[model samples]
Target: MWFFGFSTTNPRNYWIIGAIILVIILTLILKHLAIYLEYSHKHNQEDDESERYKGSSKIDCSKCCSGAIRTYALEELKSATRDFRIRIGVGATSVVYLAELGDGQFGAVKRVMEEKGGSKKMFLDEVSVLLRISHPNLVGLLGFCLDKGEQLLLLEYVPNKSLFDRMHTRHGQSSGTLSWSSRLSIALDIARALDYLHSVADPAVIHRDVKSSNILLVNDNHAKLADFGLCKLGHDIQSAQTPTTIKGSLGYVDTCYLNTGLVSPKSDVYSFGVLLLELITGLKSVQGSTTLAEWTEECRKNKNVEVMVGMLDSKLKGDVNVQQLHVLIDVANLALLENCHGRPDMNYIVDRISSCMEPDIQPELPV
Candidate 1:
């Protein structure tokens, strides 16, 4: 039958099938393109961010490290410490692992790894700055490590824990453990260190993160300031100002600095004020219901500032002259004034506090 051979060819059906296949292939291609574009965009964004961060960062290294401190490489630290085997202490800037000095040396080593801001800059800054300064009350820098992105600092091992440990060790236990003379001595030492940092150093150092925890208690009830990660020099201070990041611990941080980002020499003064309060009250600078400052002020205003005097450690009771106590507390209160400018300079403040002390209160005794 010669009937409709054209129809039997069925060109329309072939066309429909081809169109369907084409549509499927196009859909898969579009899906792949979208994924590739998304991934590429994300990767590009990451690269951009990395470049931006790298450009703004500054890293300046000094000649070795301070005699107070020394530098070691990551490999050297690993070899000396056997990979930080003995975990001793930790600070806001790094983890202090205990290690042997080796080489027939009996001294212990504190292995500190740069953990915040930028590790390399901090490593360089610490070594550079510490190398330039020497002080009796500051911890001695032993050595440091710089490798890849990891940096380690070796410091003289201090056996005693931070002031945080002493202050909060089972309530009155801390205060009772030491004599009034000892506590006062600690304050004096800290004040003296702060004074030196502000006045004597070529460029004044502002211990931005001063607190009891940063104060290391060593042999004979002595206290020394440690950790310079957040520290800045007066000239090197940020130009933009305006409340930078809140870098300090809560209770010990200067309230005025927090509010204004004005980290001057007096910044340490505010923190010392809190420390003084901590010593006087034998209570933590920070406690529940209110801050240490608030509680002290509340009691200070409502009743005689002497109401909380009973909280002093038994070892300190009456050991400190009440008249001297009054003077010290007044100094602390003024140092903690909400107005940063109202605070006294560290040098003047130290001299004043020192003047207020008895002849015996010099290096012979503190508090």
Candidate 2:
């Protein structure tokens, strides 16, 4: 009998076929083994890196702090915060309280809840990033506590609250509207912070979350980028586009990051663009199902200055510099481009915004 032109009953033919089959099987087994070994090596490397940053459950003050971060005992924080009773802000993973540190200094103490798996990771991640970075426009980490099952972070206190509180809250609205100049200044501050993170830092940092809520303001309306929980560090711009889970606030999240599950500095640029739209329109990033970015893009498609100006935050009407406003809108358009490659780097953005603040054009204060 013949099998595919080979004699099936012949001993020599059978031996030849068996040898070929065995060789093919061996090749496949070797290929699979190589793949498994590669994957195991990569995974172990990642775990080691994470372990280096994660450190022990209890941090050692002597080694961790080189005058950059202080290690606080739980009792010290509890006493400063009055047992965490003066709640100033609250989020999914933590609660912040107004604390009176000694010597009449004030600070914000963040208490990380022990309820979720990601909570501890977030705490560790924030600490790791904060330890390595320092910028005037970025929130400063004063100290941290990892004692008796409590995780607390002590941060510099900014009295004016967050940009979100100033823009969206009833109290903020009643107090006084943020002048167009203040808005522009706040935008610049945040842009500088992002620039520092993306360009100046030794290992570039991707904020991962950039929104009005994460922007804390000082009395002079200077903005500080906060919340480094979801940040990622990359040795260079190209390496920054690491694939990871999609995590960010709605509307402000980069569409590219959302679609691909890979994050880059451009993701922060996209979110900053959304923030620019928020500054222009005074609209929440999301209202019902419509996103501020989507809404602004739709309006911008009309190509009518009047139509676009009509969308400005009502309080900003008549006070806005039409020329500057146009410049800002144009910048926003570039930053919010659907293609991440088309987005301008933060340095370019800083220049464009600086152009709008030409020395002669003074900001109009709110009435």
Candidate 3:
């Protein structure tokens, strides 16, 4: 075949080569287009979920009267929080900024960012899990907003501080007193929340990330779970793993979590165990010759769990009986069980911890 250009060899050969090259280019283009579409879809879903949350909470005379949170409009949130003018806090997936509404009320607007992978799933999980559940010991979700891939969760502001700030490391062995009752109370609250997540919720929600940083403390020495309710679940319990893009805090994450990339309510218990250890030993979990797992193992092997428990703050030292401290130890130890299934269910944990708190106090709910 000859054109005005140079003489072409065989038309069939040229046609075959051109067709193959065209197919290769098309394949590459299609692959890229697939990726772009996936990303766009995720972005759009995130946007939709964020928008589902709007409006602010109004005072309800009914209910417990603890001032239940009402959803807030996105615009009302912007006005109340001064367009997020006061930067209160930030986390890996979200930011907490102070806000106010037209009613002249103060609140917090938690701005959540959809993470790199499986973000749509994570965002939806948070909204679904948090909005329906409310407990005195759990942070309240005022509302949420999703727009153009930006996700925002409005939460009730707890101003005191985090349990992490009160790390026993701050002061010496005297690290002040997280009184036995207070510590026990904190434990019970967390346990109850975990129990609710593990047993009560529809498919169940796992607080994949639990650490002292995630425990919000109030003025009355009350504690509640924070940074929780965002988790990854799957087809079944056998494969309930959250998308991995860094979960939980350093030193607090369960060792097994690294292996399976799956987190369950038990994982939260493991972290709570670390918190208990911190409460008892007055030491940062990471500041040791061995991983907390190894250290705890050594303690068990040496039959010196008492030696560790003896490190508890002396403030209420005499107030709590030996049996009580030991029980707390057992509770923490049970949560640390290497096998997730072997660990006590959160309901059992709540019962045991609540019982330990006031050996005089019995479980109020059916387990």
**Which candidate number would show the highest lDDT if scored against the true structure?**
2
112 Cα displacement, candidate 2 (Å): 1.2
lDDT of 3 by residue, 237-287 (tens): 435556455477767787677677766667777887877776655556686
Candidate 2 — which residues are off by over 4 angstroms?
1-68, 116-118, 240-242, 360-367
lDDT of 2 by residue, 97-146 (tens): 77765444567888888784436778898899998898888988889988
lDDT over C-alpha atoms for residue 120 of model 3: 62
Better of 1 and 3 by lDDT: 1
- What TM-score does structure 1 among the candidates reach? 0.71
Q: In model 3, how large is the Cα lDDT of residue 285?
A: 69
Considering TM-score, which of the candidate structures 1 and 3 is the better prediction for this target? 1
Q: How does residue 253 of candidate 2 score in lDDT?
A: 94
* Candidate 1 stretches greater than 4 Å from native: 1-70, 102-118, 170-176, 236-243, 301-308, 311-318, 364-367
**Candidate 1 lDDT by residue in tens digits, 114-171:** 4444466656776777666667788766666666667666665555667777766542
Candidate 3 Cα deviation (angstroms), residue 274: 1.6
Question: Each model's RMSD to truth, in Å?
Answer: 17.5, 18.0, 15.9
The whole-model C-alpha lDDT of candidate 3 against the native structure comes to 0.64
